[model samples]
Target: MKRIAIVLAAMLVTAAVPVGAVTAQQSSAESSAYAGTHVSFDASENAVTNYTVDGETVLQSVSTSSQANAGIGLDIALSAVTDIDASALSLGTTTETSATVQADSGATLNAHDNPKGTLVIAAGDESQYVTANLSGESKAEQVDDSRVVVENDNRTGTFIVVGDGEVTVNEEGNVSADLAEDSRLVFRSYDGERTAEDERSEELIANGSAAAEVYVMQENGSTVADTVTYDEQTTVETTSDAKDNVTMTIDRSVHEGTIVMTTVSEEALAATDNLSVTVDGEAAVEAESYSELQSAANGGDNSAYLVQETSADAESNVYVAVNHFSEREVSMTNDDSSTTDSTTADDETTSSSTNAPGFGIGVSVVALAGAALFARRRA
Candidate 1:
């Protein structure tokens, strides 16, 4: 039964893969190719602890489900030009939410579209993502702990992360995103942009030029082991033994801002210039043990502590942007079991930071581990 719960928990993200209206891409020579308001998007489901609804879609001049969609994890990625008015976004609830949004250049992410008085769209405990367009000479803004962006494509912008999450940016990933308290932000440009022309040699290749940039501002939270972990422990009465722990990775309830930026000049996937802004309240995790650890005596009673260590230590901003993504790969590695798991793990600590100019929309694998052990045996 416990194992069943773990499986369910892993799948709790109901992840509704948004089935976008499919359309083919146009040639670079086509002026209309990859035009206005193109922004990548994603959403998740049902776990909201609180909420609020708004006016009808077109009523507020926005798209409306008019209905309710169950299930949880919703992931929508727009690979082409869009006409979505960000302000027109009608969020059905304003309570506890965990949805996120991402976008590349050529895609208009007009933040001002969703005004409090205009429509009924607001999400709490959620995150946002955007890619800036350097050509349009515009910028994205957000205030969170995790953010990253680059302008190697030749654009300037600002981002703000006022949440408890962390932010990071790469080289050529130009940005003006800033970080706040417990939250962290990073900006580094070491790679060049990936251009569509570069992929001309490949019949199936889309955009070829690659850059890295991420822009984010975070507030706070803890992301740690949400599953089982068997670690070797040093014993005094015995030689050694495996220890179980209650662990999970958590981040500020407010996960806001963009994570990828590309240039529209190359391929639809390579656009930059995303503006975002977010302010989330403090969030915390109640240390819990994974069902798998039941094999240990009194394992259920053990508390947890976050074991964090960075190259720059003591929780400072660390940027890893690259003009040439082909050059670097800065990230976190963990125990074999955790590190080998998935992208969520590789990003034990994450920010809105992203790959520069190319804005490849790299995914972050965050897994914050909260570990704690008591010096007592099962009674």
Candidate 2:
């Protein structure tokens, strides 16, 4: 179901982008200091880092190394911008633990809210062993055509979209990749300077872990359109078999929209047990579609939703997982659109504003175990 939705979103984006549209290829910043001029993967390998901005070599690599930590771990550089209107911006990682790219003096990486402005964080190459750990940030008019593609090593990566324009990941060229353990991909849109380390707002957590108490946040407004929380209980045949049991806690609050936790075991499968769910304290039933989760919101503040699952089998090894998650619907209006909106939860009303350009559409797929997954798309 998640794949189907993503395919449909891709189709919509392919149709929306006009032919011969200008892609984000420029790297110009009026304020020379704000313009990204150089990038490094790590401080130790700075001399060997290779980077370019607008066809100019800001840094030259002295050695060609592919070691996991070879060269400057992760970095980028941009040439001085003579014209902001002709420039485009992208932020990603090759080997750096984290990086940032900014446009100062009210200059946006992309002109207006053009979807063509892209931000990408993907495997530097297609080789399975060529895993790269990268996290990046950039100031753009909007973030829609960007993507984060990973294959082997589960490295945490995040992308931030700043300004009145929101992020639409489903725009043309946006793609989703299956995430590995401990891997997090975030796409955020904010009005403030989130570049400060102390002001980070996104995170990924596992169930039963030390960080389980943490709650991931998104600045500006909540993008989580829906959420699901349930419990799965099964019996175990033997105490040892419990070691193989896998329990996943589904968090629909993060930017990619889903956080999964899986348990490993030293023992083999002992037995399987029947399972049932009680959504929001209701009777257990199969959800025909994710819309049911949205209905659970009750028209309140549905931005952040939580679902918990616990399982036990007759002989242990009881596995519980969610079947689906709904994407947040984006309300895009003309330039005159106002941010005067409210959501009521527990008889309490919360108001927010989003004076954005038109909306961008996209979808993100999150996997649990055995290929089971959930889907989230920006409305």
Candidate 3:
């Protein structure tokens, strides 16, 4: 009996060793610092427990959690800041300027410019899989399905959460969503230099300085319009028309840089095989790539190029690069008229009772006979 007990004890101890090792591995933490800023990542919690600037605690703790079949949960605590937190599944790399964390379910958290103090959280799997809790003096307002604006009472900074998912911010400023992959939430620290009001009021379709923006114009005038500021040198207003033939207009009077425009059509656009772009009513020349477009635009030539087209949804999206912008309109040429004409032609061809061609010939023959009879009578 004693020998049997010893053998069982040995088996139990061996089984316990691997569990303890995994626990230690999951509990490990990583730290990095840059430009008077410091960040610490806790692997066990999959969170940032400390985010400090100039030795002042700007963030207390940012943690993540998950439930069965759910994406991820995020909870943040700010020191002399707002209460916003995020939770993920695991901790990734930690660098001086940034730290990354990811969830097994594909949610990702990225803190960039830790020295400058910016945090951006994104969905990895294109699923609306991230939920955030907002507390303290912070107030969150939902701008649209893809945008949420969080502001604190002191107005020291602003957090903009954008994704292709349904974003909800209650009166308490808590944010929750099952965000699609690549959807992002960004936090920008103004350090009391700028107020939340300084941010544009329009629905932010995209911020050129931060990331790409996608806008879809419907038949109704209710389309997305935004002011995009690039490189701090150019501000452009983007708007679209409500017609079947959608027209995207960019006010590039004060623009400077290469602008990329991508479009998808249900059918082939009129007059242009790939994509159409016009500046001041003149067709702009096409370049080979975005780099070429940028070079041409910066070198005083208006140029454009079709980069790619994919025929996935019966038609492909066309990517165009342009170097200059001036009274610019990006659209399908006569899209509505072409569709109408094609439909009309199809209907005419299928109508057996109309006999349009025969009717035309009969009318012509009658007119000629009447003219000949009148001439003979006169003679």
Index of the highest-TM-score prediction: 3
Q: What is the C-alpha lDDT of each candidate?
A: 0.19, 0.23, 0.43
Ten contiguous residues minimizing lDDT sum, candidate 1: 231-240
| Candidate order, lDDT descending | 3, 2, 1
**Could you tell me every candidate's TM-score relative to the true structure?**
0.17, 0.20, 0.39
Q: Distance (Å) between predicted and true CA of 16, model 2?
A: 70
Cα lDDT of candidate 2 equals 0.23
Residues forming the 10-long window of minimal summed lDDT in candidate 2:
108-117
Which has the higher lDDT value, candidate number 1 or candidate number 2? 2
lDDT of 2 by residue, 194-275 (tens): 3332121222211111111111112123211111111111111111112222222333432222212112111222222223
Query: Which regions in candidate 2 have their CA more than 4 angstroms from the true location?
Result: 1-273, 279-284, 297-379
Model 1 lDDT tens row, 1-379: 4554444445333222221211122222332111111111212121111111122111111121111121112343221212222222211211111122212111111121111111112122223222222222323332233333323233222222323332333233222221122221211111233133211111111111111111111113312110100011100010001111011111212212111111111101111112111112111112122121121112222211112122211221111111111112222111232223343323222323212233211211111111111111111
lDDT of 1 at 335: 26
**Residue 306 lDDT (model 2):** 26
**Any runs in candidate 3 off by more than 4 Å, and if so which?**
1-46, 49-68, 71-88, 114-116, 143-145, 153-155, 193-379
- 146 Cα displacement, candidate 2 (Å): 6.6
**Residue 304 deviation, candidate 1, in Å?**
0.8
